[model samples]
Target chain A: MLSALPEAISILLSLEGILVLMLGTSLGIVLGAMPGIGSTVAVAIVLPFTLTMSQAPAVMLLLAVYAGSVYGGSIAAILINTPGTPQSAATCLDGYPMAKRGQAGLALGWATVASVCGGLVSAVVLIFAAPQLAAFALEFGPIETFALILLGMTCIVSVSTGSLIKGLMAGMLGIFLSTVGGDPILGEMRFTFGNWQLFAGFNLLAVVIGVFALSEVFIRASAPISNVSELVTFSGIELPRWSMWRGRLRNLGKSVLIGNVIGVLPGTGAATAAFISYAEGRRSSPNRAGFGDGEPDGIVSSEAANNAVTGGALVPTMALGIPGDAITAVMLATLTLHGITPGPNLVQENPTLIAAIFAGFFIINLLLLPLGMALARVAAPVLRIREGFMMSAIVILCALGIYFVRGNPFDLLVMGCAGFIGFLLRRQGFPMAPLVIGMVLGPTLELTLRQGLILTDGNFLAFFTDSPIAFVLAIAALLALMIPIVRNFRTSKKD
Target chain B: MPPTITKLKQESVIVQLLLLITAIALYLSTFKQGFTDAEAAQSPMFFPRIILMLWIVLNIIGLIQSVRHSNVTNPIASWWRILLVIAVTCVYVNLIGSEGFFLPSMVFALICLPLFGIRNGVLIVLFAVAVPGVLVLLFNHMLGMPLPTSRFTHYF
Candidate 1:
């Protein structure tokens, strides 16, 4: 473990690794600041590049991109009504309004500062918590691993805002999509439908880019605006005074804690965390009336919670090799490509790498202060660009990005199909996040169930009875399905 | 008069009927596939079946809710424009394999930009051509994942 630290430091300190990390961070911020482009796209765009790099530096590049993008989205949310990423939606409730009121500089400053603080705090927590959790996870068997994945899937309901039914449907769709490729356990093709391309299932990066980016371009093209003012000049950026900080301490604390907890859960990314934290903050605040009316506290809570998720998300990834979200999932794939398996044995085999990751987190968080400020200053000019030109640029970028995903024309076709489906779903008020989650987790669930069944020699009851953990998870899933129906009925009757 | 709850309820009924029809079709289609012992649990059909079941249930619930409170606020849809874009995209994708990345992408951009109401055709043309060309250079030449160049031409 001790020897691994020096190696980790050497890898991180190398010129190539440093350049990769810095460039990834800068590009991620730009991508993240664009409305409709999220950290998922940023990570996917960089995945191919990491194919040739070493494990430590490659993973570092992706992580830096993820963290930088998470912070970057807030800049657009603050300046414009539109959020650059879904996670920044809460930031816009107050952030845009503040900008409208001529306090754009102040809002940007507070958000940047709060983001840095939250990221650093969560990084510290991740560094301490990941190793301990990994050590504990080392004792788990396949059954336990299966149960943990099930637990992660069950959290889908918590993220089912606006409509629970739609969320479930979307999640089911995602799971179904995951089943398209050859079965991992059985090696039998499932949903290929005679197309050779389906053998590998749907590439998640392509799906995300299409559903989020391309769909966004299509939606924005029809409703173009002109000359969004980007000229923001700050004589001096004002930090939140002691009184302001003191007043919002409870909200900030609650949001950070909620964000960290949500971030540690697989499939539930920073978007869910930000939304949940905003709701919780609004519900509990004394001045709830000010929530969507440029409240500084609202901005602080959402920004802090969302940024805190960057570090919290790393906890499960580094410790257990189970990625907490899509971005980390890609990072895990990169790690695997580089001949590094990031499971329970990772720390024991390479402690220096783990320590270097922890140190990298610290460095990235510190760098956020300057990087975020500079970006905010630069992005201010974009507000003045005509909506028509902006829309054209975004559409072109989306097309190019999808093209680059696999260098296959068929991939673009898949993207177009997904975009069409997403458009229909949006029209019907069905949320898209669940579909993505379902796609991500579908194969894992199917494989686990099959393995468990195979072990039990075709006993139907064995799924529930053979393992206590699986039984518990099943019961929990049952309750989750029922509660929403019950709540909806109760609410309808009351209305 | 605006569409009342009753009219919205009727629409929901139609939606529910369509969903039930689709569900039956999906279930029937599932029978076409043959499953072996190893493929039984994690077959391709397993998840689609699950999704179909969930979709049917959700649609039914949605239908019921719409019927119960039928005050629907339908947003305006520019279907003609949307269909045009989709058609263009399909055509662009079909052309990409034969013509390669550069020309098809540029043409696709030009056709689509007009949908955004950008009347400056010259600017649009420049943007459409320049952006895709630059990207081909960046991703293909710089990034070393050069997009498929056209077999018929030596433009690059």
Candidate 2:
């Protein structure tokens, strides 16, 4: 691994790699600074454009966007008192206060520095931890893989944030939709309904573009337009004195660690991490009373934690075939589209590809400081682009991109239908992440379960008894499913 | 609390019933296909059937839970605005095949802008034309992805 580091750095330092990373970071910051766009939409919209490029630059571009957007969200939080992305909602609590106190540049600077530090730490964690976890996961057989995916599916319940039943239903619907084409093991066609186009199944790209991008247009079109605050001014890249940093070093470290840990937990996103870390900071910081009143610690905790989540979330995604959040889910879809299967064998089979991605991750963070400063200067104006115009462009792009894939008109219809369905489900409080997860993991779950059944000679009970790993994973999955219910029950009882 | 509960009850009942109907329809759709290789450990219909069963069970639980709490919030924009966007999208999708990429999409942008609260005709017209045109130029010419040609052009 140490020997490979130099090779990875050289790859990232290449002209093309640097250019792609720069473009991705800038684009991510712009989109992330814009309210209602978010990192997931940024990545999904970029996926179509990456089709013309090779896999390494394409993945690198998306990772840069993922990392850049998390940092970008804080800019809006500070300037407009609105988080460009949900992950920075906690930042807004203190960021807006700092900006109001005439320290807008300082708040942004703290956010930028903290984001860099957190992202760097998490990248180091990813570099060290992903391979080790992947090595362990390589021991998993079909049953254990099935169990692992089942555990992944349980993440939908955690992500629901509203109604578990709705999330579960949406997830089930996604799995069912994945069965629209031919059965993998059996040559028999199940749900094609006599259309040759159905034989290939709904294009994952079209579905992703439709569900994430187009559906967002539908939702945003109806959302009330936000007034961008124009009064705020950023003087220059200003950081706190060394004494300030020295005082809050412990807060920054703890928040980054918390962020990384929460990020590694599937379905819990950066927003959750930011809020948790802020609470922890309040609990332990010397400046606890100043948290929501222009305290530097509040901004550090939120920015550090949320940025750290980017690297932490990628851990499971690169190791297991499971995504830690929606952004990674889109990434997982991108990998599948590129014919690069991500699993335990990803590191062994595609060492260079994995190394390039890691290097890109590091470079994107390092570049965030300079790029983020420039972004902070222009974010407010860029974000003020009319919502209607943005929505219109997104819709047009969705139509054109879906058409470009295989030049199929049916794909446009598929995208349209999926967009409508996604809009409806989202409005009803069923999260979209679970749906994407179920679609991505559906075939794997079925294939593994059937293979395990065949291996067990048709004994379902043997699945539990024969493999200790499988049994343990199954129990973990069940616990994940039940934990929410148990927690809800306890809360209700207390009430 | 009472009003919120009542509203929740009404919305939940409607949503739950709609979900239940969909699940039933899904189950019925699979029933026509019948069992495929019933003796086989993993049949083609196996996964779908399991999913449908789970859907049915979850929908029932969801219906019961709805009676306990009102989760429905008012829609962000009016129903008409959402419907307008969907209606425009449906038309745009259908139109793109025959009308080609540029015109249908430009018109979609124009029509959608007002529904999305942008009433400036000049800005709408400029954006409507420019956004789609640039996309076509970038996607078709630059990226070399061939967009559909105008049917009228062929006739000419």
Fnat for model 2? 0.71
Off by over 4 Å in 1: A1-3, A36-62, A89-103, A222-255, A265-298, A314-358, A387-395, A479-485, B1-23, B35-77
Clashing pairs in 1: A4-A352, A5-A352, A170-A435, A174-A438, A174-A439, A175-A438, A175-A439, A190-B44, A228-A383, B140-B146
TM-score of chain A considered alone, across all candidate predictions: 0.82, 0.97
lDDT at A492, model 2? 80
- Superposed by TM-score, candidate 1 places the C-alpha of residue A113 at a distance from the truth, in angstroms, of 0.9
Q: What is the lDDT of candidate 1?
A: 0.71
Clashes in model 2: which pairs? none
Cα error of candidate 1 at position A487, Å: 3.6
iRMSD computed for candidate 2: 1.8
Quote model 2's TM-score: 0.96
* Native contacts retained, all candidates in order: 0.36, 0.71
